[model samples]
Target: MHVYADPFWLPKQGNTEEEYEDACCPRKVTERASCSFRCAVADGATETSFSGLWAGLLVQAFGSGRLTSKRRQETLRSLQGRWLSQVSAHPLPWFAEEKARCGAFSSLLGLELGEASICGGGRWWRACAVGDSCLVQMRGDAILSSFPIRDSRAFNNRPLLLSSNPGRNKEATTMWTSRGGTWESEDAFYLMTDALACWFLTEAEKGQQPWRRLRDPQTGDGTFAELIAELRRNGRMRNDDVTLLRVTVD
Candidate 1:
């Protein structure tokens, strides 16, 4: 399978260009001609611990590689073990002592195996979160499933992992599971950070169809460019870093 992958990382406007950074390293790990995967991680900069660092590390560990169910579990365990061990042995007293007010960042992954694709489960895949990042699935023009984001609840900052803290549980929960079957030829999948997701859907509601119209063949600008244009023109995504990963199975 040929992977049509494009990644855009930019800082919130007004800050210097250097203010934005991405640890997302997109890679094709295997030589299998029939398989391709798209993965992305966006770390939240402000957290009691480094959420972005953990998010990036977790994605890098599992996103690029192929995994059986067992290996996937092992990978999650090892990541949590290593991360917590490092933090415990050499405590960052400064980070621990101060209740630094920072929101959590999210990690999303989508792997296409022929027609069926699995989404979002590199440790804490089904876990609870405070922020409202979401995953959307589409088959042609219809919306399939959107992962629920809990914003009104008290447990907003906590992620649904095996151990809430790495030191406590080396095993992180699996977030991605198959809905059971292949995506049709016309199907497409989209996952985005909350800022971008909310804005994109809002535009779509206005009949702007940032996504629906982008599928038009005449303009030929491409999906990423069209979406970026929408974000730049509308002030919907100015408050945070805007990252979007889209998968279309033809």
Candidate 2:
């Protein structure tokens, strides 16, 4: 059995051609000899205050690499607590100051595919956010799951959750863990931030999964490159920084 992993990050248009305000990394863990894990952190802009810093810090904490549901919450709490301390010292006058030059939110997605299970967490959001990062599962021609962003009725882009304030009410970032299931050798995982995700899923529904298009047996040159060029040519996804990753399990 083999696994394939690919990650890409792009900035929004007109912003130095960098669509990502956060940093993402995946490392191997020894605790699980048969499985691999990946962690991603998407930092919000600096003008948003300490969001990016907070998101980055949380990813750093998971360096220990043994993630459970409890640990995920703990990691987020620690992130929040750290942010609160920093803010207490600096006292941000406005929320925008905490973000980077652009309004970005730390949307995180990770996967740990063990011999017996697959565990993951969706992106970050506050109480009022209307959307969320999607976690898509692919098995050949079928789409298994597309976890959409879930939020309370009041969510309206307020400062959601940050790693700096550990003691505050932890915003419930979504997590999925399956212990007993059958994942064929052809199963694949796709994680994407908002804009690119919407584009990909919409295309998938229209019988055009971007990855499938790129992997088409009959493509000439490179379909992925062509797709990128087409996107840039048509301004289809020039609004936000785009980050996309695909991993295949076998």
Candidate 3:
């Protein structure tokens, strides 16, 4: 199958791009046939400092296939030390030191696309997620499936998160979930952080077919930044760091 990945992201209002706490990996879109594709997104917990770094590390690990169910614990254990060492490598005040000691946290969602193993199977995808960052599969105009989260009402202020402090992640494995499904040509996939995921589900609940608007967020002014800004202005979406990785399989 052929695949293309397009990523769109924006910082929360009043925050600069550098301050954006969400992350995605393996950027640069190209339409070409391939045996497999890996993509993932992560949302940093805004309440913590240096969470962007943790989020970045998480997505890159998944994108690189370093983090997986079989080795999630070991990988996270290694990444925890990495995150800690990086943050403390520089000098810091006592209070700041305490913050760094507290560690950073983030939510993660990863997807892998490849040929189906079953007979007569064309294509298939498997995704694993921890927390509310979500994945949705779209077959043409309608959504085929949603993972880790399926209902708008399920979203809340507190989502299970992965933290640099391994103790905070003792239950990460339990919170983690996996889902898989088959896809046809022209199908689309969306990986979004919680804020937009909630809005997507809400719109779907209203029978609005939110995928119609998302096929290309580049409408009206020709920029995704403007689209998210408009959504925030109208109070149509919650104010938070918004990150989306869109892919089309053909």
Candidate with top lDDT is 3
Q: In candidate 1, what are the lDDT values of residues 145-196, reduced to their tens digit?
A: 5554322131233544322143433233445433323454556555566566
Q: TM-score of each candidate? A: 0.60, 0.63, 0.94
Model 3: how far is 146 from its true place, Å?
0.9
Q: Could you give candidate 2's per-residue lDDT for residues 1-250 as a string of tens digits?
A: 3466555555555666333465444422122234444444343543454555555564455434533456766665555656555656654456445432232235455444544343354221111111234456677777766644322222223434333433333445422322223356767666565666666666665677666753454433355445655776787553655555565667
Report, for every candidate in turn, its global Cα lDDT versus the true structure.
Answer: 0.47, 0.49, 0.87
lDDT agreement of model 3 with the native: 0.87
For 1-250, candidate 3 gives per-residue lDDT tens digits of 7888888888999999899999998655657567788889999998887999999999999988888788888999889988988998999999888887778989999999986533345688899998899899998777899998999999999988889888777575487889988888889999999999999999999989887777864532346777788889999899999988888887
Model 1 — TM-score against the truth?
0.60
lDDT of 3 at 105: 88
Each candidate: RMSD:
7.0, 7.4, 2.2
The candidate scoring highest on TM-score is 3
Candidates sorted by TM-score, best first: 3, 2, 1
For model 2, the stretches where C-alpha displacement exceeds 4 angstroms are 17-19, 27-33, 41-47, 61-67, 81-105, 117-131, 149-182, 214-226
| lDDT at 57, model 1 | 60
